[model samples]
Target: MKLDKYTVGKRYGKALFELAIEKHEADSIYQDLLKLREIFHEVPDLGDILSDVRLEPYEKDEIMKQLVSGFEGTIENFLYVVYNYSRMNDLLLMIDEYERRYDEHKSLLLGTALTAVPLTKEQHQLMEEKAAKLLGYEQANLINLIDPDIVGGVIIEANYKVIDGSIHKQLERIQELLLK
Candidate 1:
Protein backbone atom coordinates (compact mmCIF):
# COMPACT_ATOMS: atom_id res chain seq x y z
CA MET A 1 0.00 0.00 0.00
CA LYS A 2 1.05 3.55 -0.68
CA LEU A 3 2.15 5.59 2.33
CA ASP A 4 0.11 8.61 3.32
CA LYS A 5 1.26 12.20 3.66
CA TYR A 6 1.16 12.05 7.45
CA THR A 7 3.22 8.89 7.54
CA VAL A 8 5.87 10.33 5.26
CA GLY A 9 6.00 13.57 7.26
CA LYS A 10 6.16 11.68 10.54
CA ARG A 11 9.05 9.56 9.31
CA TYR A 12 11.12 12.53 8.22
CA GLY A 13 10.18 14.54 11.30
CA LYS A 14 11.06 11.72 13.62
CA ALA A 15 14.46 11.34 12.06
CA LEU A 16 15.13 15.07 12.36
CA PHE A 17 13.76 15.19 15.87
CA GLU A 18 16.04 12.39 16.97
CA LEU A 19 19.00 14.11 15.39
CA ALA A 20 18.16 17.32 17.20
CA ILE A 21 17.89 15.51 20.50
CA GLU A 22 21.17 13.73 19.96
CA LYS A 23 22.89 17.00 19.14
CA HIS A 24 21.38 18.65 22.26
CA GLU A 25 19.81 21.32 20.06
CA ALA A 26 16.22 20.28 20.24
CA ASP A 27 14.97 23.63 21.48
CA SER A 28 17.13 25.59 19.10
CA ILE A 29 16.08 23.49 16.15
CA TYR A 30 12.42 23.86 17.11
CA GLN A 31 12.87 27.62 17.29
CA ASP A 32 14.48 27.57 13.87
CA LEU A 33 11.56 25.57 12.53
CA LEU A 34 9.21 28.17 14.00
CA LYS A 35 11.07 30.91 12.21
CA LEU A 36 10.97 28.91 8.99
CA ARG A 37 7.24 28.40 9.45
CA GLU A 38 6.79 32.13 9.89
CA ILE A 39 8.62 32.76 6.64
CA PHE A 40 6.39 30.26 4.86
CA HIS A 41 3.35 32.05 6.23
CA GLU A 42 4.63 35.49 5.31
CA VAL A 43 5.52 34.44 1.77
CA PRO A 44 3.07 31.77 0.72
CA ASP A 45 4.68 31.43 -2.69
CA LEU A 46 8.06 30.53 -1.23
CA GLY A 47 6.95 26.93 -0.93
CA ASP A 48 5.81 26.93 -4.53
CA ILE A 49 9.15 28.29 -5.67
CA LEU A 50 11.06 25.70 -3.72
CA SER A 51 8.98 22.92 -5.20
CA ASP A 52 8.98 24.24 -8.74
CA VAL A 53 10.36 21.61 -11.17
CA ARG A 54 11.72 24.15 -13.63
CA LEU A 55 14.18 25.42 -11.06
CA GLU A 56 17.55 23.64 -11.05
CA PRO A 57 18.47 21.69 -7.91
CA TYR A 58 21.40 24.03 -7.29
CA GLU A 59 19.13 27.05 -7.61
CA LYS A 60 16.63 25.58 -5.17
CA ASP A 61 19.45 24.67 -2.82
CA GLU A 62 20.79 28.20 -2.95
CA ILE A 63 17.39 29.67 -2.12
CA MET A 64 16.89 27.26 0.75
CA LYS A 65 20.37 28.00 2.06
CA GLN A 66 19.66 31.73 2.05
CA LEU A 67 16.33 31.19 3.76
CA VAL A 68 17.96 29.14 6.50
CA SER A 69 21.37 30.73 6.53
CA GLY A 70 21.37 31.08 10.29
CA PHE A 71 20.74 27.39 10.84
CA GLU A 72 23.62 24.92 10.86
CA GLY A 73 24.48 21.22 11.14
CA THR A 74 21.44 18.97 11.56
CA ILE A 75 18.87 21.47 10.35
CA GLU A 76 20.86 22.16 7.21
CA ASN A 77 21.29 18.47 6.57
CA PHE A 78 17.58 17.87 7.08
CA LEU A 79 16.71 20.55 4.54
CA TYR A 80 19.11 19.05 2.01
CA VAL A 81 17.57 15.62 2.55
CA VAL A 82 14.05 16.93 1.94
CA TYR A 83 15.19 18.86 -1.12
CA ASN A 84 17.06 15.87 -2.57
CA TYR A 85 13.97 13.71 -2.07
CA SER A 86 11.66 16.30 -3.70
CA ARG A 87 9.61 16.58 -0.53
CA MET A 88 9.66 20.36 -0.27
CA ASN A 89 5.87 20.51 -0.28
CA ASP A 90 5.87 18.53 2.95
CA LEU A 91 8.05 20.99 4.80
CA LEU A 92 5.18 22.45 6.79
CA LEU A 93 3.84 19.03 7.63
CA MET A 94 7.30 17.98 8.78
CA ILE A 95 7.59 20.96 11.05
CA ASP A 96 4.12 20.29 12.47
CA GLU A 97 4.90 16.65 13.07
CA TYR A 98 8.27 17.50 14.57
CA GLU A 99 6.56 19.86 17.00
CA ARG A 100 3.98 17.22 17.83
CA ARG A 101 6.69 14.66 18.51
CA TYR A 102 8.70 17.11 20.57
CA ASP A 103 5.68 18.10 22.59
CA GLU A 104 4.78 14.47 23.15
CA HIS A 105 8.27 13.76 24.42
CA LYS A 106 8.04 16.74 26.78
CA SER A 107 4.56 15.83 28.02
CA LEU A 108 3.00 19.03 26.75
CA LEU A 109 -0.42 19.65 25.25
CA LEU A 110 -1.17 22.11 22.46
CA GLY A 111 -4.34 24.14 22.85
CA THR A 112 -6.12 27.02 21.20
CA ALA A 113 -8.22 29.72 22.88
CA LEU A 114 -10.51 31.84 20.73
CA THR A 115 -12.07 34.97 22.20
CA ALA A 116 -13.78 38.13 21.06
CA VAL A 117 -10.73 40.19 22.02
CA PRO A 118 -7.06 39.66 22.59
CA LEU A 119 -6.06 38.17 25.90
CA THR A 120 -3.65 39.76 28.29
CA LYS A 121 -0.49 37.98 29.40
CA GLU A 122 -2.10 37.23 32.75
CA GLN A 123 -5.20 35.85 31.04
CA HIS A 124 -3.05 33.71 28.81
CA GLN A 125 -1.16 32.28 31.78
CA LEU A 126 -4.37 31.52 33.60
CA MET A 127 -5.85 29.84 30.56
CA GLU A 128 -2.70 27.78 30.16
CA GLU A 129 -2.90 26.66 33.77
CA LYS A 130 -6.58 25.79 33.42
CA ALA A 131 -5.97 23.94 30.20
CA ALA A 132 -3.13 21.97 31.75
CA LYS A 133 -5.31 21.03 34.71
CA LEU A 134 -8.22 19.98 32.52
CA LEU A 135 -6.13 18.16 29.98
CA GLY A 136 -3.89 16.40 32.53
CA TYR A 137 -0.73 17.73 30.94
CA GLU A 138 2.33 19.13 32.67
CA GLN A 139 1.91 22.30 30.64
CA ALA A 140 0.07 23.61 27.62
CA ASN A 141 1.13 25.54 24.55
CA LEU A 142 -1.76 27.90 24.03
CA ILE A 143 -2.39 29.81 20.82
CA ASN A 144 -4.72 32.77 21.23
CA LEU A 145 -7.02 33.79 18.40
CA ILE A 146 -9.04 37.00 18.54
CA ASP A 147 -12.33 36.47 16.81
CA PRO A 148 -14.97 39.16 17.29
CA ASP A 149 -17.58 36.83 15.89
CA ILE A 150 -17.35 34.79 19.08
CA VAL A 151 -19.11 37.74 20.77
CA GLY A 152 -17.72 37.01 24.26
CA GLY A 153 -16.33 34.28 26.50
CA VAL A 154 -13.79 31.83 25.14
CA ILE A 155 -13.64 28.72 23.00
CA ILE A 156 -10.97 26.24 24.06
CA GLU A 157 -9.80 23.48 21.78
CA ALA A 158 -7.59 20.77 23.30
CA ASN A 159 -6.86 17.20 22.38
CA TYR A 160 -9.33 17.27 19.50
CA LYS A 161 -12.17 18.41 21.79
CA VAL A 162 -13.85 21.82 21.64
CA ILE A 163 -15.20 23.51 24.75
CA ASP A 164 -17.43 26.16 23.21
CA GLY A 165 -17.97 28.73 25.92
CA SER A 166 -18.45 31.56 23.44
CA ILE A 167 -21.54 33.72 23.79
CA HIS A 168 -22.37 33.14 20.12
CA LYS A 169 -22.60 29.42 20.72
CA GLN A 170 -24.51 29.92 23.94
CA LEU A 171 -27.05 32.10 22.17
CA GLU A 172 -27.49 29.50 19.47
CA ARG A 173 -28.10 26.81 22.08
CA ILE A 174 -30.65 28.97 23.85
CA GLN A 175 -32.42 29.75 20.58
CA GLU A 176 -32.64 26.06 19.75
CA LEU A 177 -34.14 25.28 23.15
CA LEU A 178 -36.73 28.02 22.77
CA LEU A 179 -37.73 26.79 19.31
CA LYS A 180 -38.15 23.25 20.59
Candidate 2:
Protein backbone atom coordinates (compact mmCIF):
# COMPACT_ATOMS: atom_id res chain seq x y z
CA MET A 1 0.00 0.00 0.00
CA LYS A 2 1.08 3.57 -0.65
CA LEU A 3 0.45 6.62 1.46
CA ASP A 4 -0.53 9.97 -0.01
CA LYS A 5 1.80 12.95 0.39
CA TYR A 6 -0.37 14.47 3.08
CA THR A 7 -0.53 11.28 5.13
CA VAL A 8 3.16 10.73 4.87
CA GLY A 9 3.78 14.29 5.95
CA LYS A 10 1.42 14.06 8.88
CA ARG A 11 2.95 10.85 10.15
CA TYR A 12 6.57 11.88 9.87
CA GLY A 13 6.04 15.47 10.91
CA LYS A 14 3.99 14.52 13.94
CA ALA A 15 6.54 11.95 15.02
CA LEU A 16 9.32 14.49 14.73
CA PHE A 17 7.36 17.09 16.62
CA GLU A 18 6.64 14.67 19.41
CA LEU A 19 10.27 13.68 19.62
CA ALA A 20 11.35 17.30 19.77
CA ILE A 21 8.94 17.99 22.58
CA GLU A 22 10.05 14.94 24.53
CA LYS A 23 13.69 15.90 24.18
CA HIS A 24 12.93 19.51 25.09
CA GLU A 25 14.47 20.49 21.77
CA ALA A 26 11.37 21.84 20.11
CA ASP A 27 12.75 25.35 19.70
CA SER A 28 16.00 24.14 18.25
CA ILE A 29 14.22 21.78 15.93
CA TYR A 30 11.89 24.55 14.87
CA GLN A 31 14.75 26.85 13.88
CA ASP A 32 16.53 24.04 12.04
CA LEU A 33 13.36 23.06 10.24
CA LEU A 34 12.89 26.62 9.07
CA LYS A 35 16.43 26.67 7.67
CA LEU A 36 15.94 23.27 6.08
CA ARG A 37 12.74 24.46 4.42
CA GLU A 38 14.56 27.50 3.09
CA ILE A 39 17.29 25.29 1.67
CA PHE A 40 14.81 22.96 -0.01
CA HIS A 41 12.83 25.83 -1.49
CA GLU A 42 15.94 27.60 -2.77
CA VAL A 43 17.33 24.41 -4.36
CA PRO A 44 14.35 22.33 -5.35
CA ASP A 45 16.46 19.95 -7.38
CA LEU A 46 18.02 18.73 -4.14
CA GLY A 47 14.88 16.76 -3.40
CA ASP A 48 14.97 15.16 -6.82
CA ILE A 49 18.55 14.15 -6.36
CA LEU A 50 17.84 12.58 -3.00
CA SER A 51 14.80 10.73 -4.28
CA ASP A 52 16.37 9.49 -7.52
CA VAL A 53 16.15 5.70 -7.67
CA ARG A 54 19.31 5.37 -9.67
CA LEU A 55 21.46 6.58 -6.80
CA GLU A 56 22.57 3.93 -4.33
CA PRO A 57 21.42 4.39 -0.72
CA TYR A 58 24.99 5.03 0.32
CA GLU A 59 25.29 7.83 -2.23
CA LYS A 60 22.08 9.38 -1.07
CA ASP A 61 23.20 9.04 2.54
CA GLU A 62 26.40 10.87 1.70
CA ILE A 63 24.45 13.76 0.18
CA MET A 64 22.11 13.93 3.12
CA LYS A 65 25.06 13.77 5.48
CA GLN A 66 26.44 16.89 3.86
CA LEU A 67 23.12 18.67 3.97
CA VAL A 68 22.66 17.89 7.64
CA SER A 69 26.30 18.40 8.56
CA GLY A 70 25.76 21.09 11.17
CA PHE A 71 22.12 20.43 11.95
CA GLU A 72 20.94 18.47 14.96
CA GLY A 73 20.55 14.70 14.98
CA THR A 74 16.78 15.03 14.95
CA ILE A 75 16.83 16.80 11.58
CA GLU A 76 19.37 14.42 10.08
CA ASN A 77 17.51 11.38 11.33
CA PHE A 78 14.23 12.78 10.05
CA LEU A 79 15.76 13.47 6.64
CA TYR A 80 17.17 9.96 6.42
CA VAL A 81 13.85 8.45 7.39
CA VAL A 82 12.09 10.53 4.75
CA TYR A 83 14.66 9.63 2.10
CA ASN A 84 14.55 5.93 2.94
CA TYR A 85 10.82 5.94 2.49
CA SER A 86 11.04 7.71 -0.89
CA ARG A 87 9.13 10.72 0.43
CA MET A 88 11.73 13.33 -0.40
CA ASN A 89 9.39 15.23 -2.68
CA ASP A 90 6.97 15.81 0.17
CA LEU A 91 9.47 17.51 2.45
CA LEU A 92 7.66 20.79 2.20
CA LEU A 93 4.41 19.17 3.19
CA MET A 94 6.09 17.64 6.19
CA ILE A 95 7.57 21.00 7.15
CA ASP A 96 4.18 22.62 6.86
CA GLU A 97 2.64 19.94 9.05
CA TYR A 98 5.33 20.40 11.63
CA GLU A 99 4.79 24.16 11.57
CA ARG A 100 1.07 23.71 12.07
CA ARG A 101 1.70 21.54 15.07
CA TYR A 102 4.22 24.02 16.41
CA ASP A 103 1.75 26.86 16.10
CA GLU A 104 -0.89 24.85 17.91
CA HIS A 105 1.53 23.96 20.65
CA LYS A 106 2.26 27.62 21.10
CA SER A 107 -1.37 28.65 21.07
CA LEU A 108 -0.94 30.80 18.01
CA LEU A 109 -3.11 31.71 15.08
CA LEU A 110 -1.23 32.27 11.87
CA GLY A 111 -3.05 34.71 9.65
CA THR A 112 -2.60 37.10 6.79
CA ALA A 113 -3.56 40.76 6.50
CA LEU A 114 -4.23 41.63 2.90
CA THR A 115 -4.15 45.29 2.04
CA ALA A 116 -3.45 47.78 -0.72
CA VAL A 117 -0.09 48.68 0.78
CA PRO A 118 2.38 47.25 3.23
CA LEU A 119 1.52 47.61 6.89
CA THR A 120 3.59 49.68 9.26
CA LYS A 121 5.11 48.04 12.32
CA GLU A 122 2.45 49.59 14.53
CA GLN A 123 -0.32 48.49 12.20
CA HIS A 124 1.08 45.00 12.03
CA GLN A 125 1.15 44.74 15.81
CA LEU A 126 -2.38 46.13 16.03
CA MET A 127 -3.66 43.69 13.42
CA GLU A 128 -2.16 40.77 15.25
CA GLU A 129 -3.83 41.88 18.47
CA LYS A 130 -7.16 42.43 16.72
CA ALA A 131 -6.95 39.15 14.87
CA ALA A 132 -6.25 37.35 18.10
CA LYS A 133 -9.25 38.96 19.73
CA LEU A 134 -11.58 38.40 16.80
CA LEU A 135 -10.47 34.83 16.33
CA GLY A 136 -10.62 34.08 20.05
CA TYR A 137 -6.96 33.18 20.23
CA GLU A 138 -4.47 34.41 22.80
CA GLN A 139 -1.84 35.07 20.16
CA ALA A 140 -1.74 35.65 16.42
CA ASN A 141 1.06 35.72 13.90
CA LEU A 142 0.04 37.92 11.03
CA ILE A 143 1.85 38.27 7.74
CA ASN A 144 1.14 41.32 5.65
CA LEU A 145 0.14 40.62 2.07
CA ILE A 146 -0.31 43.50 -0.30
CA ASP A 147 -3.10 43.28 -2.88
CA PRO A 148 -3.55 46.51 -4.73
CA ASP A 149 -6.95 45.47 -6.05
CA ILE A 150 -8.30 45.67 -2.50
CA VAL A 151 -8.28 49.46 -3.04
CA GLY A 152 -7.85 50.22 0.69
CA GLY A 153 -9.06 48.82 3.97
CA VAL A 154 -7.93 45.30 4.73
CA ILE A 155 -8.98 41.70 4.42
CA ILE A 156 -8.10 39.29 7.19
CA GLU A 157 -7.69 35.64 6.27
CA ALA A 158 -7.23 33.44 9.28
CA ASN A 159 -8.26 30.13 10.79
CA TYR A 160 -10.22 29.17 7.67
CA LYS A 161 -12.23 32.39 7.78
CA VAL A 162 -12.09 35.57 5.78
CA ILE A 163 -12.96 38.97 7.25
CA ASP A 164 -13.48 41.03 4.13
CA GLY A 165 -13.38 44.68 5.07
CA SER A 166 -11.73 45.83 1.86
CA ILE A 167 -13.21 48.62 -0.24
CA HIS A 168 -13.68 46.17 -3.10
CA LYS A 169 -15.93 43.98 -1.00
CA GLN A 170 -17.82 46.98 0.36
CA LEU A 171 -18.50 48.22 -3.15
CA GLU A 172 -19.70 44.82 -4.24
CA ARG A 173 -22.06 44.69 -1.26
CA ILE A 174 -23.43 48.14 -2.17
CA GLN A 175 -23.87 47.11 -5.79
CA GLU A 176 -25.84 44.05 -4.72
CA LEU A 177 -28.03 46.18 -2.46
CA LEU A 178 -28.76 48.59 -5.32
CA LEU A 179 -29.66 45.69 -7.63
CA LYS A 180 -31.98 44.24 -5.00
Candidate 3:
Protein backbone atom coordinates (compact mmCIF):
# COMPACT_ATOMS: atom_id res chain seq x y z
CA MET A 1 0.00 0.00 0.00
CA LYS A 2 1.27 3.43 -0.97
CA LEU A 3 0.79 6.10 1.68
CA ASP A 4 0.41 9.66 0.51
CA LYS A 5 2.66 12.46 1.77
CA TYR A 6 0.03 13.72 4.18
CA THR A 7 -0.50 10.31 5.73
CA VAL A 8 3.22 9.80 6.14
CA GLY A 9 3.66 13.31 7.47
CA LYS A 10 0.81 12.96 9.93
CA ARG A 11 2.32 9.83 11.40
CA TYR A 12 5.70 11.45 11.92
CA GLY A 13 4.14 14.71 13.07
CA LYS A 14 1.92 13.00 15.61
CA ALA A 15 4.88 11.12 17.00
CA LEU A 16 6.94 14.29 17.29
CA PHE A 17 4.04 16.17 18.86
CA GLU A 18 3.49 13.44 21.41
CA LEU A 19 7.15 13.40 22.29
CA ALA A 20 7.23 17.17 22.66
CA ILE A 21 4.19 17.13 24.90
CA GLU A 22 5.73 14.40 27.05
CA LYS A 23 8.89 16.47 27.33
CA HIS A 24 6.89 19.60 28.20
CA GLU A 25 8.23 21.31 25.07
CA ALA A 26 5.14 21.26 22.89
CA ASP A 27 4.81 25.05 22.54
CA SER A 28 8.51 25.57 21.83
CA ILE A 29 8.59 22.73 19.31
CA TYR A 30 5.50 24.04 17.58
CA GLN A 31 7.10 27.49 17.36
CA ASP A 32 10.23 25.98 15.86
CA LEU A 33 8.16 24.09 13.33
CA LEU A 34 6.42 27.31 12.37
CA LYS A 35 9.80 28.96 11.88
CA LEU A 36 10.84 26.03 9.71
CA ARG A 37 7.73 26.57 7.60
CA GLU A 38 8.61 30.24 7.22
CA ILE A 39 12.11 29.30 6.16
CA PHE A 40 10.73 26.81 3.65
CA HIS A 41 8.46 29.50 2.28
CA GLU A 42 11.33 31.98 2.06
CA VAL A 43 13.65 29.48 0.43
CA PRO A 44 11.44 27.54 -1.94
CA ASP A 45 14.30 25.34 -3.18
CA LEU A 46 15.35 24.23 0.32
CA GLY A 47 12.90 21.36 0.08
CA ASP A 48 14.23 20.38 -3.33
CA ILE A 49 17.81 20.36 -2.07
CA LEU A 50 16.85 18.20 0.89
CA SER A 51 14.81 15.84 -1.24
CA ASP A 52 17.19 15.70 -4.19
CA VAL A 53 18.53 12.19 -4.54
CA ARG A 54 21.45 13.49 -6.54
CA LEU A 55 22.82 15.02 -3.37
CA GLU A 56 24.80 12.72 -1.09
CA PRO A 57 23.27 11.86 2.29
CA TYR A 58 26.17 13.63 4.06
CA GLU A 59 25.52 16.81 2.12
CA LYS A 60 21.83 16.69 3.06
CA ASP A 61 22.75 16.12 6.70
CA GLU A 62 25.06 19.12 6.63
CA ILE A 63 22.31 21.27 5.16
CA MET A 64 19.81 20.08 7.73
CA LYS A 65 22.27 20.69 10.54
CA GLN A 66 22.97 24.21 9.36
CA LEU A 67 19.30 25.07 8.97
CA VAL A 68 18.16 23.58 12.24
CA SER A 69 21.19 24.23 14.42
CA GLY A 70 19.34 26.75 16.55
CA PHE A 71 16.68 24.28 17.58
CA GLU A 72 17.64 21.91 20.36
CA GLY A 73 16.54 18.52 21.62
CA THR A 74 13.36 17.09 20.12
CA ILE A 75 12.99 19.41 17.13
CA GLU A 76 16.66 19.19 16.17
CA ASN A 77 16.69 15.42 16.57
CA PHE A 78 13.46 15.14 14.59
CA LEU A 79 14.94 17.15 11.70
CA TYR A 80 18.02 14.96 11.70
CA VAL A 81 15.89 11.83 11.44
CA VAL A 82 13.83 13.38 8.66
CA TYR A 83 16.98 14.23 6.75
CA ASN A 84 18.46 10.78 7.37
CA TYR A 85 15.38 9.25 5.77
CA SER A 86 15.52 11.71 2.83
CA ARG A 87 12.05 12.96 3.74
CA MET A 88 12.92 16.65 3.78
CA ASN A 89 10.38 17.16 1.02
CA ASP A 90 7.72 16.14 3.51
CA LEU A 91 8.86 18.64 6.14
CA LEU A 92 6.30 21.29 5.30
CA LEU A 93 3.47 18.78 5.32
CA MET A 94 4.74 17.43 8.59
CA ILE A 95 4.88 20.91 10.11
CA ASP A 96 1.31 21.60 9.02
CA GLU A 97 0.15 18.29 10.39
CA TYR A 98 1.95 18.95 13.64
CA GLU A 99 0.36 22.37 13.99
CA ARG A 100 -3.10 21.00 13.26
CA ARG A 101 -2.71 18.24 15.81
CA TYR A 102 -1.35 20.68 18.40
CA ASP A 103 -4.25 23.05 17.80
CA GLU A 104 -6.75 20.22 18.14
CA HIS A 105 -5.21 19.23 21.43
CA LYS A 106 -5.33 22.84 22.62
CA SER A 107 -8.95 23.29 21.57
CA LEU A 108 -8.07 25.96 19.03
CA LEU A 109 -9.51 26.19 15.56
CA LEU A 110 -7.44 27.65 12.73
CA GLY A 111 -9.41 28.99 9.81
CA THR A 112 -8.95 31.05 6.68
CA ALA A 113 -11.20 33.82 5.45
CA LEU A 114 -10.86 34.67 1.77
CA THR A 115 -12.28 37.89 0.41
CA ALA A 116 -11.89 40.17 -2.57
CA VAL A 117 -10.13 42.71 -0.40
CA PRO A 118 -8.55 42.89 2.99
CA LEU A 119 -11.01 42.99 5.85
CA THR A 120 -11.11 45.70 8.46
CA LYS A 121 -10.08 44.78 12.02
CA GLU A 122 -13.69 44.96 13.15
CA GLN A 123 -14.86 42.88 10.21
CA HIS A 124 -12.16 40.33 10.87
CA GLN A 125 -13.01 40.07 14.57
CA LEU A 126 -16.72 39.70 13.83
CA MET A 127 -15.99 36.95 11.31
CA GLU A 128 -13.74 35.17 13.77
CA GLU A 129 -16.40 35.32 16.48
CA LYS A 130 -19.02 33.98 14.09
CA ALA A 131 -16.70 31.24 12.88
CA ALA A 132 -15.94 30.27 16.49
CA LYS A 133 -19.65 29.98 17.25
CA LEU A 134 -20.39 28.10 14.04
CA LEU A 135 -17.59 25.59 14.54
CA GLY A 136 -18.30 25.18 18.28
CA TYR A 137 -14.69 26.10 18.96
CA GLU A 138 -13.88 28.26 21.99
CA GLN A 139 -11.80 30.52 19.75
CA ALA A 140 -11.06 30.76 16.04
CA ASN A 141 -7.85 31.91 14.44
CA LEU A 142 -8.84 33.23 11.04
CA ILE A 143 -6.17 34.37 8.66
CA ASN A 144 -7.16 36.76 5.94
CA LEU A 145 -6.66 35.82 2.31
CA ILE A 146 -7.19 38.71 -0.09
CA ASP A 147 -8.37 37.24 -3.37
CA PRO A 148 -9.56 39.74 -5.92
CA ASP A 149 -10.84 36.88 -8.04
CA ILE A 150 -13.46 36.14 -5.45
CA VAL A 151 -15.17 39.34 -6.71
CA GLY A 152 -16.80 40.07 -3.32
CA GLY A 153 -18.15 38.48 -0.14
CA VAL A 154 -16.12 36.04 1.92
CA ILE A 155 -15.29 32.37 1.95
CA ILE A 156 -14.64 30.81 5.36
CA GLU A 157 -12.85 27.52 5.64
CA ALA A 158 -12.61 25.69 8.95
CA ASN A 159 -13.10 22.29 10.50
CA TYR A 160 -12.67 20.58 7.11
CA LYS A 161 -15.58 22.48 5.63
CA VAL A 162 -15.84 25.40 3.21
CA ILE A 163 -18.49 28.06 3.54
CA ASP A 164 -18.43 29.88 0.22
CA GLY A 165 -20.12 33.26 0.35
CA SER A 166 -18.17 34.59 -2.63
CA ILE A 167 -19.94 36.36 -5.43
CA HIS A 168 -17.79 34.41 -7.86
CA LYS A 169 -19.25 31.18 -6.56
CA GLN A 170 -22.76 32.60 -6.69
CA LEU A 171 -22.31 33.68 -10.27
CA GLU A 172 -20.93 30.29 -11.22
CA ARG A 173 -23.91 28.57 -9.67
CA ILE A 174 -26.31 30.84 -11.50
CA GLN A 175 -24.53 30.27 -14.76
CA GLU A 176 -24.58 26.52 -14.24
CA LEU A 177 -28.32 26.51 -13.61
CA LEU A 178 -28.95 28.70 -16.66
CA LEU A 179 -26.87 26.38 -18.81
CA LYS A 180 -28.73 23.37 -17.50
What's the lDDT of the predicted structure labeled candidate 2?
Answer: 0.89
Give the alpha-carbon lDDT of every model: 0.87, 0.89, 0.89
Runs of candidate 3 exceeding 4 Å displacement: 114-119, 144-154, 164-180
lDDT score for residue 154 of model 1 = 95
Query: Per-residue alpha-carbon lDDT of model 3 for 1-180, expressed as tens digits?
Result: 977888889989989989988999989999999899999999988988998999887887788878987888888889888887778889898998889988988878898999999999999999999888887877889999999999999999987999999999999999999999
Minimal lDDT window, size 10, model 2:
70-79
lDDT of 1 at 133: 80
RMSD of 1: 3.5
Give the TM-scores of the predictions, in the order they appear: 0.72, 0.86, 0.77
Q: What clash pairs does model 2 have?
A: none
Q: Residue 149 error for model 2, in Å? A: 2.5
Rank by TM-score (best first): 2, 3, 1
Q: Which residue pairs in model 3 clash with each other?
A: none
Candidate 2: segments with Cα more than 4 A from true spot:
none
lDDT for each residue of candidate 2 in 124-158, tens digit (9 for 90 to 100) = 99999998988888899989999999999999998
